[model samples]
Target chain A: MKVKSIQCKKCAAPLSLHGGGHRIRSLTCEYCGAIMKVQEDFALLGQFKDQSHPDCPLSLGTQGTIKDVLFTVIGTVSYRSNYGDSWTDLHLYSETHGYAWLSYQLGHFTFTRRVRYLPSRNMKQLSPREILRVNDQPYQFLEAYQTEVIHVAGELTWIAKVGDTSILRDAISPPFMFSQEETENEQEYHLTEYIDPEAIDANFELEYDTHRSFVHPAQPFKAPIRKALSKASLIPMALSVLFMFFLTLLNMGNTVLSERITHSQMTGGLFVQDFTINNANHLVEIQFDNAYGSRFQVKDITLFDDTHEVFTFGKKLKVKSSTISSQQGTAQFKIKKAGKYTLRLRAITTRKWANSDRITPYISLTIKEGVMNNRYLKYLFYISIISFLLFYISRYFFNKKRWE
Target chain B: MPNASHYINCPQCGNQLPLTFQYAKLTVCTHCDSTLFIEDDGVRLAGKQSVLSTIPSLLELGSPFSYHKTSFVPVGKVRYAHTIGYWEEWWVIGNSGKGFWISVDEGDFAVEKPLDLDSRDVASIPSRDDLYLGQTITLWKDQWQVTEIDKGKCEGFQGELPKILKVDDVVPFVHLSGQTGQLITLEYLDTGIEAFQGEWIDPFEIKREG
Candidate 1:
């Protein structure tokens, strides 16, 4: 049946069913604000003084095709859960089909419809562990909650009054679900399935991006976030690989210009050992291995090449960590002329914090002419690992915050 | 099989009475008030009276509704009431001319067809009082629970009904339900036990109307 013209009996205001259905039973008049019951004559069923509802992207009377079915938005109802979160349900009416609903919560959308089938088992006895097969699809029990209608607006086919409570039981297998709204008198069942916001927005030709929050709880974005982060990390990772390759190219040499390893003991308060670099075209390195009997702090070690100061160390450094105190210090001395380079070292023989009986310990000294002690490679190795770790950790938390 | 264009002359009122229900044992004359019942010997009359009610159901008597993607035109209605208010059972003639009932109780609606009584053993079925909530009662190898058992009286009726019903006729019916929204109404009458199987529905979900 099609609606030609209808009048509100309460105020005699001309009204028309928004969806063009003559089967409209109870609807509130937009002009004088009176609920009219459609019959031979419109009877005043109730007075809708405060008709309020939440704002939604899909407005009333907005026609959109969902699942290949065209539906008109006829009503909107707001429901507040016990957890302080609320959602809006948009009732869609199809004159030749039936009623369907779209629920929006924080930009997440779900389309639902009342479903009926021959249920073989007792549904009330089912728990989460049990599975219910409907139309060859398996749905697992999720949870049950009670919700109350806080507000409503527009025309709804069923009675939509405020403070009307219903116990809703939900079962799901991802986007698809089986739901039942149980009241004192009747138990209404519905099959609900979620719709992607992007698809819905595209179909309705509406912009919902601004209305959507940064993250949707039910949206599957964590995996995609992780994948994007991994792709982004290729920049830093590639930098590290390139940096390591450069270090490998720079530190390529096996030139031992001069070498000497000699052990000598000095009973005096200080000792000095000299090693000469006979050949020096490449870099020259003068190394010393001092092993003492006990743990002791050593004063500054300085080396002089031909009485010209070459290398020095600041601060009292630690010897060997074990009882056999082993310490190593190196100094680089490069001479343009290939000649004997005499190097001198300084040491302290005082047994401070030492646990040994020998006050004097033997020290070994070696001088190389071609080896260069460049510690940039070691530092670069440590910094690369730390940087990669920090970058990966930041990406993890960034995605977690956005998705959670 | 019942014919959608089936018509007969009423013996009591001498008016055209359309037999729309397949298992209809009773038919009412639209022109004259004649409650006639079909019998093996011949069509007899329990009494001649017209049925009337004030229940405003969109799927009222002689209205069209759809079920399972099929169109059905209701030709009879049964009015019943318990303590709360009145509910209705509209007997519809399906596209195949089969008899089915669309029961409207407040916002809760269902379309049901009569079940075979002799198909199941009812010796173990508990009475409506003994069955608690969440309990199951087996009928014809299917399990259902008595959700609400109330005694309702037939206030009025119109059109064609499967069984002959009159005003002030008392009936005790137990509303049995299973997990799939599968509902069964076990009505106890003087004619013994009667079973009806159906699934609950939302009235607004019914798409077409005539």
Candidate 2:
């Protein structure tokens, strides 16, 4: 029979009819202790005794104990609007000794239910009273079905009780109507098509029956740090790349500048050479036998004599680089005066580094002129005196505080 | 499918002319007195003299000094200037010889005194009184000696050229020309005496003017 909603006439307290095949001879109100007779059938379903009863009101069930109850939940194949559409799977068996019913309490409502044992699993084949059973006895179904609303956030869950019987069956069948052992003798087939016979006994093993329902959390599930960082997008990465590119460009410019400096100060050679100094024209020429060991271009060539500055030559001096045959190497300069001068030479070989920290040293050389008191020495004397005077005048007032 | 070079004969004057780009019904002939209307493949009438004009001009080249501040003094007596129709002009000159011409615009310039030149007559002067940009001196040959050191009421030439002004922000420039070779541009503010100048901004700047 269907469970109904009831209220006390005096205090207006609500109560639910819960047990299957339950009966009552008389009832008294707890507030007023007044007695009332128990009534049966659908007409008096939700009606209760007055507050004048001596104790709480009770109702009775005319059928035997509720039994063979099944708790089921159906959810949308995808997702849907109904909450109760999700059910539990709890099938029970009962005996004449006591009333048994399956109860599932999810959040608010406790779904108390019982089922009947019909001739077939198909409900359409049996009459109402014949199909519906309580405590191994038959009772007609009360309504289409009872629905108790349970408020839940995401997923629907419940605890199911399937075998609540006063009398114990000698053997119990497996909870589900299918098992791998029962289908062993059949031809090897897909597991989806398998089903087994339903049997019940008091002493038979019963699968653990306590089942809890819970909702699985929905998620884009990221840990706190990772999620926060991802939300910032590619901004940090872009900044890093841009910074690296600028740094690389700056390094390249510096390399170019340093290379130019080295090229201005070095040169090298191998062989006997004749040096000439033209005091009037201020020119010097060095002729030598070319050493063919390497294709060494003169990176820079400078000529210095005693105390004055000769050509501190290089690309800066407008000295064009030339490739000479193995027979000869010639170096020339525009000298201010004729003199025996110390000639310094350097040859820089162009090279690129494969590693970031590779180092390249500047190439250098030194050559001393023979004997100092030559005719060029007199001209140098005058040049030195004039240079001193110019230097003195140029720095005449470099260190003065003005605007004070 | 009409080719651009095809021509038709005029029926009135028996003259042949190519079709003009513009579409029109009647055209006036340039060499004859007649009106011409092209029908099918032939001109039906001859036209009077048609006015002729010269080709229109677009994207004409800019003036000579179109670019500004576009020159680099890479080293001594060597300057590269980016200008009209050229990437850069390289100017090179031996210390004592006349500077070489690297462009059609500017010819050779003289070299006053090469620091490495041998003649004692040549004297050199430091570009600036400051220690910045590595102190460098401008060398003058003995012939061009410092004759006077005037120190009063000195005034620079009133001009907009960077080489003329010595005070107010512009640095002293190395004035180089053919025959003159290399000369220090001493502005009127300099007074040819270093005593009054407190400090120098740059050693010397290389200035190029038309």
- Report the lDDT of model 1 for residue B187: 82
Q: Candidate 1's residue-wise lDDT over A26-129, tens digit each? A: 66565555766554255677765665556678876677777756677776778987766788998877643457889888788888887766333456777754
Query: What is the C-alpha local distance difference test score of each model?
Result: 0.65, 0.27
Q: What share of the true interface contacts does candidate 1 keep?
A: 0.19
Best by DockQ: 1
Candidate 1 residue spans exceeding 4 A from truth: A1-16, A20-25, A30-33, A37-43, A65-69, A94-98, A106-108, A114-144, A169-180, A188-202, A207-217, A222-226, A231-345, A352-404, B1-140, B144-210
Clashing pairs for predicted structure model 1, backbone only: A123-B179
DockQ of 1: 0.10
lDDT of 2 by residue, B85-151 (tens): 1111122222222222222111111112112323342223433333233223333432222322222
> Measured with DockQ on alpha carbons, how good is candidate 2?
0.00
B96-159 per-residue lDDT for model 1 (tens digits): 7677778876445788898775534455456556766666667667777667777888887777
